[model samples]
Target chain A: MQAPVLGVKALFFDVFGTLVDWRTSVARESEKILGALGFDLDWLAFADAWRGEYQPGMEEVRSGRLPFSKLDVLHRANLVRMAPRFGLENLSDEVLDDLTLVWHRLDAWTEVPGALTRLKTQFRIAPVSNGNISLMVDLARRNGLPWDAILGAEIAGDYKPKRQVYLAACAAFDLEPRQCMMVAAHSSDLAAAAACGLRTGHIARPNENGPGKGEASPSVPVDVAGSDLADLAGKLGV
Target chain B: MQAPVLGVKALFFDVFGTLVDWRTSVARESEKILGALGFDLDWLAFADAWRGEYQPGMEEVRSGRLPFSKLDVLHRANLVRMAPRFGLENLSDEVLDDLTLVWHRLDAWTEVPGALTRLKTQFRIAPVSNGNISLMVDLARRNGLPWDAILGAEIAGDYKPKRQVYLAACAAFDLEPRQCMMVAAHSSDLAAAAACGLRTGHIARPNENGPGKGEASPSVPVDVAGSDLADLAGKLGV
Candidate 1:
């Protein structure tokens, strides 16, 4: 692989499974909250099941089958659908709401805070995730990630893999798509952003979805690829 | 007056006058930049004239006379329109562009940082100004405002005092209007938010418009009124 030259002005990140370790965080929180109520099953699988609904739920909006609803609302409906499968039923509405918000409390990958702080000194940084504004805000506050703004599905009124989400985030910064880099662990996200003319930087998150469920590298070519955000920042000369 | 009981969960601020001293900052920057370039005029009046175009510019979009453009674009157009009067006509595009970005560097009012840091412990805080996302982000970064997200005209695709802009910001937080307090130095801003059912907190910015041109207090009733952010935070028991 040759060293790539890029002129990126801002970096837009995919939050879930990219900057944050959502899988483990969700599993841990599920066990802590649900275990307290004596509803103990395969917590990790429960977490996976909850996350499995994410894409299909988004597809409903992307396909225009439903008007855009925020990720929190979708998460709640997903949680209800998966609740009975895990011996959890009839939970109070408040408790169910708290469990769904586990996504908002996900812990960041170890190097994210330091790397992002370094990146911010050189380039504008924001999360262009599918998560809604309140969820993104909660996650940023909980983890100390210094984002310039929250940009994503909520503001775009559409989910990614959809081109409007990528284009809208760039428009928010008044930058051409080519001037912004999309950083993510998932190649598909980078691919979607790249398709919209954003530069793509890939970060390896081998443990993003438990041990064996995550990809260790980008499955496709990107402008830059590195082991993590710190490495990516170094690669970009930040 | 008896202390007003409030159950506010979030505080949405009007950034330009309420939190930051934009009039002074813009005038100072204009004088420094344009003075260096050998143009002379009443710099403060130049700043006022520039801002004076803001509401009317927004009204163009609010009335559907023009499609929604970000505040930065509108500011640029307004700057160009006022340039000849200030002996700034025929400046290079780069210089004009840089001048328009003066809004990004506005200094926060003296009590903002400390008061907001204290208030953050109790509520979700954000700027619900008409400034676009990029402008708000740059201003927040320059002034050390710990905003959870940037929300306003750009995100809402319409400027305030439009009801949709206020309602959109509240919706971003999944908050009821009554649960969010709109904080501002301008009565009309508060009045607009209040009409949308939001609670209001008035901050006195006596020098907001380069002295005497600005109001020192809300012209209408509000749930809370204070001398500055620190006073407001104290009044709110933060």
Candidate 2:
């Protein structure tokens, strides 16, 4: 293995696609809840539509059209907006709530648990995603991810790609941005993080969007790259 | 066990005196560092004097006299103020910085780890402390305190007994105040938490101060009380 990057004291992860397999998990959960209701829509497309609204939902807050709100609240609003299009317009609050909470029960990519446990020995590891604190906590509890702290949008009062979100996570550790590494599968997320002076690590998630969706890897160079979390751990010399 | 307080889902702890024996730990760290520098003074009294300034320091921000700042920054200021009185007028920047970080190395009370471990099995546990996130993370890592998240002054932008701190912690869990319990050794802290509609758990740290300092338990009634964390865990049926 190559020598680990020097002076990196913490690892901040991008959760939705980089760590948790939200696509499959959400699809499974939507199938269970919607199937029981006798709604036979394409669950994966429903999941994609729900997720596609994430950026625009955050953009409302980011653009100051709406005040800062938790991701869960934004997600619920988006879910409500999409329900009618998906033919589940009359779903009860109970079903809607369960479908929304599927984000909390997301399955971590196969190597997440052990890789994080290994990396944690050498560095403080935390999520720096757009997920709100409660959602992050529930996801951590459900997936057994060992996080040193739950930090993200709710903690920053803003979503990622916002300079404050990245800087605030670094400040939370009392460390300089260069002393931490932002790990994500998306080039755009890493580029935003790198612009804020954080070191970058990339985990290639070629199947993050499901079999044919092909979510692309970083176009920009990263300090480290791995096929999976275990590969990242190995390369980090953890 | 009496049903674990019905619907209590999270336990928020007071860190300084309740979970950690800060007086002892701070005194020891001070003695070790200062003694090596050829200084001799009332170390325990120094610890108390340093800690006694906590609430007043926070009041500056809570009252809006100053903008929000991390506890570490406030702690350094307090250390600077108290330095000359102990004949440490010429302390170097590095030494002062190290001394300020002693709060990060406090030892947990003997029963804390096992008790928290047990309680974590049944409910979320976190520190609702005045210490900044970095300090809390350091203390957790040093002492094996299993926190679901670090929530406190940093997140709330205000110090405790302020409704914002308690409310923010509850909000982080997406919980009502009544569904969360404030666990502390100080009645005043618990009382403030109760005023915000949270349940309260009392842990008796009769020796939190120096041997004869005689720190007292809660003067008001608490929902649960125990001689130590183990006793508290047993009482909570964890």
Candidate 3:
């Protein structure tokens, strides 16, 4: 309810569910691919299941149970395994490669780019995503994300919720961790960033899954919270 | 001469000499600091010596004679040793810190931003500098360099003229080394990049030392050569 404090020099974003609607986008793309293959399945559930793979897959890498690899490589590895379960038949390597790049072709939430443009006038904006730099760069160029830079877990050889990842971003910007704010829809990311001494902002993505979809509340108290990026920008006076 | 072929997708620039007039900038700042202390020295030569310290300092790190350190840290360590030689006296920690950031406050060559803007429309423009990321980011933001991203040798744990530095930029953009181009005033930087399979462009910074001073030419053959950034942009038809 109260106005958010200013003086944050850089805003690090959680890319997937925060700035972009990955679930809907991935489901739609999977549906199209399935249709093209003359097959059908519950694409929505498949999309959610694929999304669910992210945290655990990253855990494997973080725990050294898996070899060091890029998010794109991990995404592709997951996709190849999930394809048959989702009724994808006889997918060619070229087709799978194109599908892996679907993450790079995600649409920005309608309010995202506009809010980012306004924020860019006053602050440095970058995505602190689990996605690799190349994937994030391609996504930004494709969606006009207007990121001043792309900060990724790849930069630190680890994923989010890791203190080193957030510290790496602060180091890259030459700022104390407290001077940068992590903006995300997820509480885990905000909590991790906050624990690492960063300020935090929560932008609720109520329609992140569209009509009748369940929405969860952030589990931690962030420095600020808002309904969307537009509201967050307004609160930050950008 | 004939029009240069220009199918380069990304431009990886040499920061210190290509975009920024480090000689004048560093000399001016060093002179101001020395004057405040009532010391006198040929600040221009001092600047050259300070610049010269960069390579050997990095070579120490590169050759494993010294531990890996960021350029700013390396610069500060060298400056502490070189300050007495420059007749600087009573330099406190704060003064040393301010002096170390001289690299961060560099002024761009007058033609840089405009040419970069023009080229950005056709190619991804970034600085592939030996400078660290934080220093380069500050320089770009302060000087309005319009870099799409900052690629630095610090990210690769080594300095330029090394293959890993060039390969890091290509990896960052997810491009084949040949798809990217190294744009530098120094032919040797371009040669190093080319040896890594990148394309190369040379924009002659004849006034690299300001109005009357001259330096030895880089001892390598660059792929494309032009008078300046405008001339280079024109050659690239950007």
Put down candidate 2 lDDT per residue, B1-238, tens digits, no spaces: 5754789999999999899989978999998888998888888899998988888888899899999999999999989987788788899999999999999999998889888989988999889999999999999889888788999999999888899999999999999999999999999999999999999999888777776453456788789888888998888887
Top-down TM-score ranking = 2, 1, 3
Model 2's chain A TM-score stands at 0.96
Model 1 misplaced regions, further than 4 Å: A1-5, A89-92, B1-5
Candidate 3, B1-238: lDDT as tens digits:
2233445678888988888899989988877876787777888888888887888788888787887788999999888777777666468999898889878888998888888888888888788898888788778777777677777687788888878999999988888887888888887787788899998888777777666443334457766666778888877876
- Looking at model 3, the pairs that clash are none
lDDT of 1 by residue, B1-238 (tens): 2256367889999988889888889999988878888988898889989998888888889999999998888999999988888777798998888998998889998889889989888899989988888888888778788888888788788999999999998999989999899999999999999999999999998878876767798899999999999998988998
Residue-level error in angstroms, candidate 1, position B236: 1.7
- Interface quality of candidate 2 as DockQ: 0.82
lDDT for each residue of candidate 3 in A22-70, tens digit (9 for 90 to 100): 8888888877766686767777788887777777778988888987688
Candidates, DockQ? 0.80, 0.82, 0.52
Q: Estimate each model's TM-score.
A: 0.94, 0.97, 0.92
Candidate 3 CAPRI level: medium
RMSD of each: 2.2, 1.5, 2.7
Off by over 4 Å in 2: A1-4, B1-4, B212-216
